[model samples]
Target: MSLVDFSSDAFIVAFFLYCFGFLFYGVAIIGRKFSNRNPDEHMHKWGRIAFITSVLGFIAHLTFFFTRWAGGGHIPTSNMYEFMTFLAMMVMLAFIVVYAIYRKPMLGFFTLPLTVIIVAFAAVFPQEVQPLIPPLQSIWLKVHVTTAALGEAFFAVGFAAGLMYLLRVVDFNSKEKSMRIQQRWVEFTLYVVVIIIAFIGSVFAFRGMGYEAHFIQETVEISSQGVESTTTDDVKYSMPPIVKPYNSQVQSMDSFLGMKEPLFETPSWMKGVDAARKLNTIVWSIINGTILYGLIRLVLRRRIGAAIHSVMDGVDPEDLDEISYRAIAIGYPIFTLGALIFAMIWAYIAWSRFWGWDPKEVWALITWLYYTAYLHLRLSRGWHGKKSAWIAVIGFVVVMFTLIGVNLVLVGLHSYAGV
Candidate 1:
């Protein structure tokens, strides 16, 4: 096979390995109670097995990265698919480092599943390698994207640990107002994760069935020379349309589940390229996510958070909190270097400006500032445990919005990254 083909195969192997690692980690955590052997010994043996599997998966993932780099003639991080896959690999790397330091099996229980979800999510985007755009043709593209994603991967690990800390410590059965509020927010966070999984499922299901719809969207632009120009472009969807593009005509649409046409037109305010498609995807995610959540709730007859919290009974909240803090602390400076310094250097070379108020740039700044405040509150205000964990969790939301939401909802210099 060609190196690119081999890389693709290696990526598939890595994905399965990660999934197996997650399952093994789950067994290490959950099977201990059921095993005939001593609990500590059982966990130790399974955790060791899981760790080895994860390390092998990381090696396979690295193989994929290097082979793809060699074959594709550029780093495999120029698009959403490549970037997300790379981020997943980096998360595994970060997890490995933290796991070695802490030797906590429960950490793998949380982190491996996250790495699996990320790798799966990355599959939702197109995987075909394309030539880098003119703006992305600099060496800084490699430096900036790789470093930024690596930093974000550490934040992802912190998020997993922080979330686990919350689960371990939160009073899921409490009737007190404060605890109830925390319970609801934790459930909401889990629902958001479910939504992401639902999105990946929905995309793959439709893609497998070869579902498609087409539209021709028109745009009118006024130039600096006082000239008005009109353009029309073709937009395609792999999933059924819940909303059509603004000011667009349907070219062809495949009927889905007896729905032949879009239920609504996109708002005029959402003028970003393929904004309607993105909105449709979001709508489907919520719909499918809610249904899946309902099914899980039905099976357990308890809140999802409560169900998860049961498995977290013996895990120390303090250790999780410390891991979360340390991971973020390590990531913050790297993020500053990658997202700000290197980005500015690249921006100057590309746009002749170090700072532009583009939506992406603005959100990146907002993310940096939010995390800066997190560190300040953590150090200066003495936030720890729940408060610190909450910030770590929320900070990841900020990081994700900076990475994804800006691309989907706003048009800017970084729009070429795709949805």
Candidate 2:
């Protein structure tokens, strides 16, 4: 077998192992409440195990990607499967580096499950091999997308960290209220993770059980007012044997006609429009995440951790304000350089245009504007502390929209992402 075939099989096994690890980790987390367990309880022993397993998983993930690239004779990020895999891998690697510096294993608690999620979603997309189209033959495809994805991955880390910070800072006077908060977070997390896993997992599990996407084409007759319109028959549309992610590179006219008929035999009119495959990558981002997280704080109704609360209880609000200011000072410029300048330069090289008002591009502009306003609010109007942190959090929502929702929902020239 080719190296890629071997690698694909290996990656599949690695994915299974990763899923098992997550189950154990989740059990361990819940077990903490029951058995008075701490993630760092064994300190050295559990940490070592976590590190080894994570590193091994990361290596196998990289091997799958590199092997695929070797077989294809190009970058592996040519489709949604490849791109999602790349992004998730980048996030995991970033988490490892951050954990090394921060010495915080809690971050892994969030990152690992999320990595599984993106990988699971990727499994739903088509994985069949296809040659690269002419437009994808540019050096910047590697440069622009890679750096941008890494940058987004960094911000994702920041978002997760920031959420943890929020949770740590929050508290409730009543145990009842606190329990409610914890339960809510757990339920939301479960909803998201389960839905994605079930969607993709079912597809793979059934396929493994010898089921497949069956595509067949046939014509039907329609009679209107006794005028029979016999659709020229003998063309059967069936799903691809293996469902792969949608490829925007396919000529739409030819691509549409190639789809298998609706499994339930819906009328042709019921077939959905194939504009941009998915645009949710950018849409869910604008739903006021800062407000949501902030509102949670309001409901919690008291300071959370005694240690953190005590540390903040006496410090001048201005000092805390300055710390937040410094974080924004460091993050804003880097975000601009990564999301806007790098992206535009890459787009110009690849698409022959600096900007096309693609939904993803537009959301990136929205993110920039959000942060710009944040800086202005901070420096000029003296916004700081709770307000400033709130803005920083909001900025992340914009960034997420730019990074994920756009690719998932919005359709445009940047549909390469939806692939």
Candidate 3:
């Protein structure tokens, strides 16, 4: 087999091991005999074993990385799919380092699923390893992006830590029915995350092997001079859309059960067809996610968080808070130097400008500022408990927007990230 093939196989093996390790870690925290016995007595051993399996998975991930690097003749950090995989691997590595310090098995329960979800999300993008284009074909590209991802991985772990801290300390059991409903919604959001991951994964898994469906789309395009033009073309997509794009001519009688063409035309500058295609695909993914979530709710007959809470009897919110702080403390400076400093260096070489206030650059600054405020409140003002956790959670949301939202919603210098 080719090195790329080997890498793909290794990655698949690693994914299975990570899932198993996730399960094993859950078994560890819940203990052998539950409420009758001491929590995490003999069960801690299982935690160690789970860590071992994850380490084994990480080793395979490493193998995949090196093999793919050797095969591609460049680092596997160019595209979103590759970057996400690399980021997930780094998050696992960071989790391992933190686990060594704190020896917490429950951390794995949160972090592993996240890693799985991220890696699975990576599969949503095209997996083809194309040669690096100009501007992107730079040595500093590797240096700048690599450090940024490593820093972000620790930040991702901080998110997990913060989320766990909130779950444990959150006053969800309120007598007020509205407050209780809000709590259930919060719990429901977690499942939604997983559902989106699964929905995206299923789409890419089946369709990734080069699936395509063509539809004659009646696209309404607005020109720069405020001229409206209606153009029709056969558009191709990898996944089957439940809803067609706005004003699309239907050659094939596919399902348009609840889809409606919008009255407004696409923006003048925007590539209307591509925008429509992405929108349609995303809508279908959400539809699939809702169905999957409904099935999960039907099966469990309770909120996912409540079900997970059954085994969270012995978890420590304080430990979670501390780890979240520490992870951010470690990641911040590294992020500053790489994402900002080295990015400026690379940008100067590429665009002959240090900062142009591009959407990406703006969001990067926003992320930095958000985390900076987080550190300030955490250290100086002594926002150590629930407030800090909320900050950490919000910080990651900004990070996600920087990483994903900017790439998709706002096109700029970092448009390659959309790949």
Local distance difference test, each candidate: 0.91, 0.57, 0.80
Task: Give the top-scoring candidate (lDDT).
Answer: 1
Clashing pairs in 3: 218-249
Point out where model 3 deviates above 4 Å: 31-38, 176-185, 205-212, 217-233, 253-271
Clashes of each: 0, 34, 1
Q: Which stretches of candidate 2 lie over 4 Å from their true place?
A: 13-17, 20-41, 166-194, 201-272, 275-335, 371-400
Candidate 3, residue 374: CA error in Å? 0.7
* lDDT order of candidates, top first: 1, 3, 2
Model 2 vs truth, CA RMSD: 9.9
Predicted candidate 2 versus true structure: per-residue lDDT over 196-277, tens digit per residue? 4554544565446552232223334456667654332122112222222222112111132354322122334422233211
- Worst lDDT 10-window in candidate 1: 410-419
lDDT of 2 at 202: 47
Go through the candidates in order and give the C-alpha RMSD of each one to the true structure.
Answer: 1.7, 9.9, 3.3
Index of the highest-TM-score prediction? 1
TM-score, each model?
0.96, 0.64, 0.89
